[model samples]
Target: MHIVIPIITAVVGIIVGAVIGFLYRKTVAEKEIGSAEQEATRIINDAIKSGETKKREAILEAKDEIHKSRTEAEREIKERRNETQKLERRLIQREEALDKKSDAVEQKAEELDRRLAKVQKTQEESEEVRAKQIAELERISGFSRDEAKEYLVSTIEREAQHDAAVKLREIMQKAKDEADANARELISIAIQRCAADHVAEATVSVVPLPNDEMKGRIIGREGRNIRTLETLTGVDLIIDDTPEAITLSSFDPVRREVARMTLEKLIADGRIHPARIEEMVEKSRKEIEQIMKAEGERATFEVGIHNLHPELVKLLGRLRYRTSYGQNVLKHSIEVAHVAGILAAELGLDPVPARRAGLLHDIGKAVDHEVEGSHVSIGVDLAKRYKENPAIVHAIAAHHGDVEPESIIACLVQAADAISAARPGARRENLENYIKRLEKLEEIANTTTGVASSYAIQAGREIRIIVKPEQVSDDAMVLLSRDIAKHIEDELDYPGQIKINMIRETRVVEYAK
Candidate 1:
């Protein structure tokens, strides 16, 4: 029991001691916390004071910055305002100057208008005076103003024409001395050397029949034979009352030739049937083809031109049957080739190409009747098709003056063609055409101003114009001739150059009282 009591007391004592210790620790903790809060309060108070000092410094700095910025802005504003005032003053001055200029321009314009009105009034007054003077002069001279003006104009025109004629004569004389002599010599030489024969052949071929009875045979069994022949050969058989003659007419010489040959063969064979006519026509076509080929070859050989296309050679041969104004085209072509070659030789150029071009210059004429274009165009196309030289093609195209001749060979071909066609006896026109040509020549001269009388002499080759001595002076005669010649060249299609002769005779035939 004693031991238990002591143990309880000890335990109570230990509990008391732990309670005291706990209380002491709690008091110490509160004291330490209170001291720490006071230290934190002191630090916070110092921070507030430092913050207040820094805020005051910042306010002072901001105030100073605002004052400096305001000062600079005011100074800049004043400068800009001063500049704006100066610009405004300059604009006002310029406006004033522009207004002064406008006023001066207006005054000058008014002055000019006033002067113009004064000048117009003066002109009207002068016109009135001129009208009065003209009326008085017209009354005194017994000539109207229009008639007097016409007379004055005529006089001026005559004088001007005389002066122009003098100038033209001088120029022509100079040109003749420089170029015409050589040109004339070359043309004459070429023409003389190219002496080709020409026989007048027409589109109609006259095939002699054995008897008039043969006409019935040719007409043949309801005209079937003639129809077949014409159909085969593209020729017209004119069976007329002409004794022992049958005319084979066709514009195409090749067809006419074929028809002629067929008729001859049928007559000789004594078998006048449609089938025989067909066979004969076919055979004649072949024969004509062969003849053409031979002629083409002959042309090439004669021209001394080689390497021609086969088709081109055949076309050349076809030209053998063609005619131009009753002149054999093949002969003309051959002559042109010769003349062209001679001219080329004289010009110190290659003659072979010139001759070739001249020979083929009229190549288109061979197929012109069958084609739908001019001979020049057809010839150019054919030459191009045959792959001829470009120079030769150009010559062919330019031979008829269809195109400008650019190459020497082309010009030579042109000259040669002109010479061939223009030489004496080279071509002939029908009587009607000849008379029309002469009449046209005379008419041209007669219609010319101041022409007193005119006559076409030398078979329409020369036109003699007798001018009025008072109207057309001696100096004007040269210009009149030139003008007339130019007119003839432009209007007429003659073979050769025409001669224009101007005769001005002034005889002062007064009465010998």
Candidate 2:
């Protein structure tokens, strides 16, 4: 039992030694960790101090830069202020100089007024002396001032009238000579220089067939083909009485053209059915539009008129199917343009505007059938709607005398229209009616006042009237001619213009004769 007790004591002593060694080791480890933490804190404090120093340096630099900028701005402001003060001083000096010049001018004006007043007083005195001299002379002549003045005025008026009559005769003679020669040369040159394609009025359009057998096909079962064609084309189809040719008749030229094209296309396709006819008609209408556009472009190019409104160009193309009397309207328009241009050039006018106006003058005829008014009125309205120049609108309206001509261009347009229409073979009229009308016009002129005799000349385009000098004075003859013209205009429905010539002669016979 004693051995066991000593063993337990030895174990107890060993346990105590182990516990003290563990405590010492733990204490040393704690000391080491504290030293490491203090060293880390010292390093962090140094880093923070370095960052603060950089921030302070940046702030100091920013403040210094701001101060520098302020100093520069102050210097610039001072410089600008000095410049403004210098400019103000110069302006003050200029104003002082202007004031001095104004004062000098006012003084000169006052002196001139004083001098004018003195001159007026002198003139009054001179007038009084002249009046006394005139009164003495009148008394010596045994005539009062009023009577003498009346006789002098009468004598002067008689002499002046005689001189004026002589001068007027000379002026009229010169003007007539120049005007006649100019008109002849201009009209002749214009006619000769312009060459237009001859196009006759076509009442019937002919469509050529590929073969004789096709004509039979065109006249389908029970005449259904021809009936459908007529119904679709709005034209009468005369399929018989011709070999390999069919006639399309329509009063409207545009309809006739469309019908002709539609038939030609249907024949080429060898398809003769109602459905085919409708399709072909529609296609032909489109083709006609394209042709119309192309023709319009061609006409504009030929006339050298550009930038026409698209609608205006299309209307111009429509003139291709229009006829005036017997002349093709498109060709006639081209001719008129040429004539108007030549005449305008000779008259020292702008030829392009004149030519353009001429080309478009008859454009209203294209739409006259569809529209309510005469072509002139329609054309004027159209031109105005398109924002055309007022002169151009005036020319359009007055070409037919539907409106009063306001410009020289308008008169030129009327003259060109007349020349175009009056040219031989340009138009056709009923011979019997034309002759009867001319006879009636002559009869009417002969029946007018101051109409001693009358004769129609120039294919009844002009009438020459002889007047009795005693009954009709020179002034009365002028009035008589105007009256005759008005009567003719009101009484006749002539295609073109008619001129009236009134002749009054006064003969003074001498023994030498």
Candidate 3:
């Protein structure tokens, strides 16, 4: 009983301690909860202050931005207003200026109208005066008003014609002076550039024999050898009294050359048979052909030309044997080419075509013996056949002034040809023919109207026509000169060209008063 009581007392003490412990834990928990509530309230207050600060800052920033935008807007509006006011001021000034200009124009128009009215009144007064003068003139001169008016009109027309003639003379003289200078310079340049040697070709070929015995051997077997040679070579063998020389005469230079070579070979070989003669002639022919080709190549090389048709080259070489009025045709062609090229270079034209045309200008002479036409016609046909440029063909045809020169190249070719042929000893003309040519030139000029006298000078190179000043006005002198030139060109067959000069002067004789 005693042990149970003690145990029950201990149990009661333990319960009391447990109760105290529970109360202590509850108090601590309540204090902690209260602290947490205080902390939450403090945190909520701090958040509210932060939010207010941010809102106030944002509001201030928005107000500042709004103020800035409003300020900019106001500034822009002020600037626009200023610009608009300036534009309006300018517009108003322009309107005022236009108004002034309009007023000035109106004043000028009014003045012009007044002047026109004054002019009309003056014209009326002048018409009355003119009518009274006409009446007086008709009464005094025993002429009607119509006759007086016609006489006055004729006099005015004469004066006008005289003035117009003088003006025309001045213009023509100025233009001719400039043109003549340019032409003279170009021709001089061409002549200076072309320094070709003159080759005086002839229709006869003289072969030097070893002895006079060779002449008899040449005419062997009762003139059978000479006959065979003439028939084969188409040339005349003239056995003249000249010692150690035989003359081969033929109009065809090629045939004459072939005959000369054939005779020379026969003399050298001392084989006088017909068979050997034929063989030698054939060899001579082939050799001459080769020489012709070589000459053609040399000519092209010298002239700096290339790409010629083989047949054309051969024909060009044929010109080496040809002659026209004692001038070597091939040499003449080369000279003409040089002159033409020089002229073309000076005149700013292509020298190649000019040179080519000039080289082939006398190509017709090569085949003229075979063809029945003028060298110009034959040359044109040949050029066309060779597929040459039309300008080149025209140049060839017009080199002799046979056809009208249609281009500058053709005109240059004509001038070059003239210069080439006009050189001293370049051509042969009998004294009789030369005198006749001069007389014909003077006659052509004298037949023209208003020509007092005509003189052909410079070996008929130029004709000077003196015109009566009273009959020929300055303008008429120009026309008369042209007409005479044209007529001379049509009627006369001249070498190179002829220059026609018309002289007209009024010499008023007045002694000192």
Backbone clashes in candidate 3 total 0
Which tens-of-lDDT digit does each residue in 1-513 have in candidate 3? 999999999999999999999999999999999999999999999999999999999999999999999999999999999999999999999999999999999999999999999999999999999989988887899989778789989999878877877787789889989999998898888888777876576655899999999988889888988888888888888998999999888878778878888888898899887777788778888888998898888888888788888878998899999887778889999998899899999988889988998898999999898999998999899889888889999899888777789999998888888888888879877789889888888887777778899899888888888899989877566556767878988899877778887788789888997
Error of 3 at 30 (Å): 99
Candidate 1, overall lDDT?
A: 0.89
C-alpha root-mean-square deviation, each candidate: 8.1, 16.3, 11.4
Per-residue C-alpha lDDT of model 1 across residues 1-513, encoded as one tens digit per residue: 999999999999999999999999999999999999999999999999999999999999999999999999999999999999999999999999999999999999999999999999999999999999999999899999889999999999978877888788899999989798899888777767776775544554999999898999998989998898888888899988899999888888989888988889999999999989889988998999999999999999988999999999999999888989878898889988999999999889999999999999999999998899999999999999999999999999988777888999998988788878876676777899889989998998899999999999988878888899888777867867878888998889776578888898878768887
Off by over 4 Å in 2: 1-172, 197-219, 238-247, 268-270, 450-457, 464-483, 489-513
Those runs of model 3 whose alpha carbons end farther than 4 Å from true positions after fitting are 1-133, 141-150, 466-470, 473-476, 501-513
Tens digits of per-residue lDDT for model 2, 380-426: 88888878778888888888777788887888888888888877777
* lDDT measured at residue 315 in model 3 versus the true structure, 0 to 100: 86
TM-score of 1: 0.67
Q: Which ten residues in a row have the lowest lDDT in candidate 2?
A: 196-205
Give me the displacement of residue 210 in model 2, in angstroms: 8.4
| lDDT against the true structure, each candidate | 0.89, 0.84, 0.87
Per-residue lDDT of 433 in model 2: 83
